[model samples]
Target: MRVSVKVKPGSKKGPLVETDEDGSLIVFLRERAVDGAANEALVKTLAKHFETRSANITIESGHSSRLKRVRIEE
Candidate 1:
């Protein structure tokens, strides 16, 4: 499955996930957006949320931006 996500890095409110009215996902990461830390955290968090492994998740776009498109392979 593919999903659109809005990522908030270094957030005190997360790691948390919420769905927007448009059916997109909002993901907050506790890790900072430095040295790819937030990206790694995002993948791990999504894996847990979707009940899958980290390897199953891939960030197809927006690696350096707040908006990301993720592909989850089941």
Candidate 2:
């Protein structure tokens, strides 16, 4: 399944929220968006959320933007 995600980097706490209108997932990362730290956090967060390994998650698009598309391998 393809899902839309909005990433929030440098957050004090980590949590995932769902958009009411679009149903996109909002992910919060405690790590700052530097040197791919936020991206790594995102992958880890998603992997845990889907009960999968970090390697199973891949950022398909928007690597440098707040909005991203992630592909989760089964």
Candidate 3:
């Protein structure tokens, strides 16, 4: 499955996930967008939330942007 996500990095309001009316996801993360830290955290957090393995998550696009497309192998 593919998901459209807007990531909020280095946020105190983190550890949260919200959905928009467009069916996209808003993910709050504590990790900053530095050296792929936020990306890693995103994968791990989403993995737990989706009840899937972290390895199954892939950032298909927007590797450096806040908005990203993630592919989940389910």
Top lDDT model: 1
Task: Score each candidate by Cα lDDT.
Answer: 0.97, 0.85, 0.96
Instruction: Give the residue spans of candidate 2 off by over 4 A.
Output: 15-20
Q: Candidates sorted by TM-score, descending order?
A: 1, 3, 2
Error of 2 at 42 (Å): 0.2
In candidate 3, which residue pairs clash? none
Kindly list the per-residue Cα lDDT of model 2 for residues 13-45, writing each as its tens digit. Answer: 685644546788889888889999999989998
Among these predicted structures, which one has the highest TM-score? 1
**Span of ten consecutive residues with least summed lDDT in model 1:** 28-37
Alpha-carbon runs more than 4 Å astray in model 3: none
The TM-scores of all predictions, comma-separated, are 0.98, 0.88, 0.97
Question: Predicted candidate 2: what Cα RMSD to the true structure?
Answer: 1.5
Better of 1 and 3 by TM-score: 1
Q: After superposition, how far is residue 73 of candidate 2 from its true place, in Å?
A: 1.4
lDDT of 3 at 61: 100
So what's the TM-score on candidate 3? 0.97
- Model 1, 1-74: lDDT tens per residue? 99999999999999999999999999999999999999999999999999999999999999999999999999
